[model samples]
Target: MRRRFKLATLTAALCLLLVSLSGCGQSLAQKDILQLDRHSNEITWGVKADTKLFGLMDVRDNQIKGFDVDMAKHITKHILGTKGQAKFIQVTSQSRIPLLKNGNIDAIIATMTITPERAKIVDFSNSYFDAGQSLLVPNGSDIKNVRDLNKPGMTVLGVVGANSVQNIKKYAPKARVLELQDYAQALTSLKAGQGQALTTDNGILYGMAVQNPGFKVVGGTFTKEPYGVAVNKGQRPFVREINKAIKEMQADGEYNALIKKWFGNVPGFNYKELER
Candidate 1:
């Protein structure tokens, strides 16, 4: 009887703990947001510092800089004003959701594709950038597109936690896939000849091509990847604020200017297509 009572008590305590944790994750109110932004004058954003053009660390200043970084800055200013602070935390594809769910990040502005699966877990703002999946291969390679990858022994590379890893198999059932932690690692493996082709959104592939010559993006596109800013699920107030900021940027031509600043001179990429 005593042992049974002890076990029951432990179970009750566990339940209470879980309930408290669940409530702690409840949606944030507008006032709470204002307090955080005003009290701290800073917002925490998750970003990818290893992915070039989207978010990469600049050696010169040892600071993260890219399209996502710029957008995060502009959004922070919109939310917190010129003196508002924006703190960026490096997050990989696999780590982003967990970090956001744990409250380590207030928002995610990484080159993350908005998908139904992710939407179920976190609220996402409207599509801020449009992209499509494609293949990046070394120059003079015979593999022209994804269809060509559907052959015995052909290997495709993708970033872990990215939908592309699973989506690639839909088009090339016979090909094998290898997932790395980030875009930089995927490209390094590609150059090392570990895989026949690297698969990701064309915009990212183009960025990779710029840094590493002799590699070209082929196979126009296989999937539509709409990039969105993500926040913890049920944060409707925060989501609305982000959407408003994005729209404001578009109205002022800041959106187009940012697109040009990052992707303007890349060969084989048409910046006009991204103009607001």
Candidate 2:
């Protein structure tokens, strides 16, 4: 009887172990973004809701609009056909990676730059947009470029969690850096005279400039900031599909058209330079 009880206990523990292993396998399979999207026929994307020319909330329509949003929709069509829905969830720089890691978002297309540090945590798609770090200053200000901000007592505004803030440290070692929550807040602070210059990607600066004519993007790009779509570390399939879709769009001229549609008329910007 003692031997039989021991045998029964051992058998039950083994069964529990197998069940736990099976659960783990199911969890991993569920996290495979490509398979998940296929099964649901939808791609949930994390995108910026504050940056103009990239992604911005359209208050009138209660929908987000901009280049990133459009690109995501087209990519969804390419990947999942006409029926596959592209769902956009607003994400800030601070939240995007965490949200992705936690399975809250399938991918990130929020003007995110691919850096070695970030690559360690998540996989990135091929460069979809070529951008560069630059500065925005009030017109007629003596600060013509990034170099001007290197002087002591000069204050530069940057968005928190954006690589631009880190990049600025290399260029303006002596300048005081103030990090804001978003582009809107940075621009507001800049306008309020809280900082002498606002720094970020030239494309984003240009978007701000277009709306606020008093300010302008200066100091042509200081660092290359090639934007890429980000997926969880193990999601190679999703990354490949995104890369493939980008190439198709470029090949068919859809990419250039989107570029023109959003950027063609911006003052002081050469839209053709961005066209594929």
Candidate 3:
């Protein structure tokens, strides 16, 4: 009787263990494809809602529209197998990575610069858009470029939590950097005479210049800032799909069409320079 009782207990324990292992395996499988096609046939893509030309919300149409938006949508169609139902989530430069890591966003197509530090935390697609750092100053201002910013007592304004602030130290070691909370605040500070110049990507600076004609990008691109689509680390399948979509767009003229749609007419920057 004692032996039979022990045997029954062991059999029940083994069954429970097997069930637990099976449940764990199913969870892992679900996690692997959580960001794929599981959500209403929609892909939630991260895009900048404030940065004009690249990714901005069109209030009139109630839709986000720009170069990045169009490109992301194109990639979604290729990856998700359709584009009509995908969604856009407004993401800032500081929030893009966290959103992707937390599963709040499927992918980030914001003007995110690919860096080794960022790559360690998130997987980046092949370089999709190539840009460079530039300086923006009031029209007729004396600051010509980054070289002019390397002077004691000169104040350079950059957006907080952006790579631009970090890169500024390399270019202007002697200048004082004042980082604003966001691009809007940075622009306000620039207008209020808080800094000698505002530094960011040339493409973004062009958007600012267009809105405020009094400001213009000077000393053209000093540092290369290659933009890439970001996904959570270890998502190899998603990364591969994004890269393939980008390559297809590049080969089929879709990439150039987006560039022209947003950037073709922007003043002070040569569109032809971005070909290929």
* Candidate number of the best TM-score: 1
lDDT of 3 by residue, 211-251 (tens): 99899999978889999988877678878888998998889
In terms of TM-score, how similar is model 3 to the real structure?
Answer: 0.87
- Superior by lDDT: candidate 2 or candidate 3: 2
On residues 1-276, what C-alpha lDDT tens digit does candidate 1 reach at each position? 999999999999999999987776554322355456668999999999887889999999999999999999999898778998899999999999998877788999998899989999988999999999999999989988899999999999999999988889999999999999888889889999999999988988898899889999998988999999998765787788889999999999999999999999889898899888
Q: Candidates 2 and 3: which is better by TM-score?
A: 2
Global local distance difference test of model 1: 0.90
TM-score of each: 0.91, 0.90, 0.87
Over 4 Å off in model 3, which ranges? 1-30
**Cα deviation of 133 in candidate 1 (Å)?**
0.5
Q: Summarize candidate 2's per-residue lDDT along 113-191 as a digit string, tens digits.
A: 9999999999999998999898999997999888899999999999889999998999999999999988889889999
- What local lDDT score does residue 158 receive in model 2, on the 0 to 100 scale? 93
Query: Whole-model lDDT for model 2 versus the true structure?
Result: 0.92
| CA lDDT, candidate 3, residue 259 | 83
Candidate 3, run of 10 with poorest lDDT: 28-37
Write out the backbone clash pairs for model 1.
none
RMSD of each: 2.4, 4.4, 6.1
Clashing residue pairs in candidate 3 (N, C-alpha, C atoms within 3 angstroms): none
Whole-model Cα lDDT of every candidate shown, in order: 0.90, 0.92, 0.85
